[model samples]
Target: MVKVEFAAALQRHVPCAPQSVAPGTLRAVLEAALAAAPGLAHYVFDDQGAVRKHVAVFVNQQQVRDRVRLDRPLADGDSVFVVQALSGG
Candidate 1:
């Protein structure tokens, strides 16, 4: 199973906790997580099913480059971290 975790900063806005799920592509795993926490979908994804601009998804410490398509595959035991991207220099 893949472990999905929410960053501390994002947890302030939503109730998503660390969870384990079946391995699949980034989109598939994310959709499954959203099903478990219906309300969290809006904060992570946009109306067109794309990851929100402010959201960052990392798989096993590597940033997901395909934000629009989210086709990156996840293997068993992988860790996915979801965080709100920070801006402003």
Candidate 2:
């Protein structure tokens, strides 16, 4: 199973706990998560269905490069973390 977690910043907007999901692309897994926390989708993606600029996604401790596509494949037991990135000084 793939584990997905939302940072404290996102938890404030939608009360969700870390979840375990079937292995798939980052997009597919996050889409599943959106179903569980319907209200959290908007905070993670933009109107264009892309990850928001202020958000960061990490798969097994490696940061993802494609914020728009999120096609990065996931493996069983991989840990996915979505966090709000810090900006400004």
Candidate 3:
């Protein structure tokens, strides 16, 4: 199972910040997640399906820098966290 978490803003679409999902690549996992929660795509990604500039993802606690790398493989029991990044000066 892949555990997914979202920031509070994302919770409006998925009440469960932390959700378990079937195993798949990061792309597949995110696609399935968007299908499950239609509203989330707009909130997390841009029209071209790239992760929003303000968004960040972590797989097994390691930050992912390449949004195009979504097709990267994911192992079972891995935790996937999607959250909006905070910025301030």
- Order candidates by lDDT, high to low: 2, 1, 3
lDDT measured at residue 28 in model 2 versus the true structure, 0 to 100: 94
Error of 2 at 62 (Å): 1.3
Q: How accurate locally is residue 62 in candidate 2, as Cα lDDT from 0 to 100? A: 83
Q: lDDT of candidate 3?
A: 0.79
Per residue, candidate 1 scores C-alpha lDDT tens digits across 1-89 of 98898888767867777788899998898888767777888888889988888888988898886778888888998989998877664
Total backbone collisions for each predicted model:
0, 0, 0
lDDT of 1 at 33: 74
Residue-level lDDT tens digits of model 3 in 1-89: 88777878688656644567788989788777667667677887888888888899888899888876588888788988888787764
TM-score of each: 0.91, 0.95, 0.84
Residue 36 displacement in candidate 3 (angstroms): 2.7
Relative to the unseen true structure, what is the Cα RMSD of model 2?
0.8
Question: What's model 1's lDDT at 56?
Answer: 89
lDDT at residue 70 of model 3 (Cα atoms): 82
lDDT of 2 by residue, 1-89 (tens): 99999999999879888888898999999988778898999999999999999999988888787899888788898999999888875
